[model samples]
Target: MKVCLVGSSGGHLTHLYMLKPFWQDKDRFWVTFDKEDARSILKNEDVYNCYFPTNRNIKNLIKNTALAFKVLKHEKPDVIISSGAAVAVPFFYIGKIFGAKTIYIEVFDRIDKPTLTGKLVYPITDKFIVQWEEMKKVYPKAINLGSIF
Candidate 1:
């Protein structure tokens, strides 16, 4: 199965990376910021850099939405996954139109509240994973998978 790993840089990126065991054998690519950490960690993988400063940034959001359309159409991954900041919104929404399954893992730091990205994608996500059981109250259908860290 082809997998598309999408997330912001830093912590969000690390969260998705921790799932290497699940994606290691699959045909996969990454969509993240073109930052030092992402560049270094994903050096051996196929990577696409999306527009950043995405939180509450309308311009970047529009840019990323366009980028999402282009990337999702080209990659056509079987599944799209993310532990996000904001970049995942466009990708998840667009991926759904492409008929790709989506998985959203809420960041471990958030236990009682949902991240904006999580709230945005939850409605369409095929699998919503939460690192803490308390998050289930925020996302009733979420699976409590504990910490990915």
Candidate 2:
């Protein structure tokens, strides 16, 4: 199956990368920030680098949303997965409209609180996987798949 693996750089992308064992064999492409780590790790993969500073900035969100739409249209992935910072917001929501099965993996660091990306993507996501049981309290419907670390 074709997969669109997406997330921001740093830990979010790190968590997404943990799933490489599962998705590496699948037909896949990535959508993420153009940061050093992402470029270094995904160097040999099909990567679509997107804009950053997506922390509720209307202008950047709009721009990224358009980029998300364009990439989803072109790739037509069967599944779109992300462990986010902020960029996953536009990608998941827009990809949902395009009929891609959207999966959002809550980060491992968050225990006391939920990330804004998790809260925003939950409603539209097909599967919301939490790394901690405490998160199940925050996201009741979320699947507690334990730590991705």
Which residue pairs collide, candidate 1? none
Candidate 2 Cα RMSD (Å): 0.8
Q: Against the correct fold, how does model 2 do in TM-score?
A: 0.97
Query: Highest lDDT among the candidates is held by which one?
Result: 1
Per-residue accuracy of model 1 over 22-105 as CA lDDT, tens digit each: 999999999999999999999999999998799999999999999999999998999999999899999999999999999999
| lDDT for position 9 in model 2 | 88
Model 1: how far is 99 from its true place, Å?
Answer: 0.0
Using all chains and alpha carbons, the TM-scores for the candidates as numbered come to 0.98, 0.97
Q: Which stretches of candidate 2 lie over 4 Å from their true place?
A: none
Error of 1 at 92 (Å): 0.5
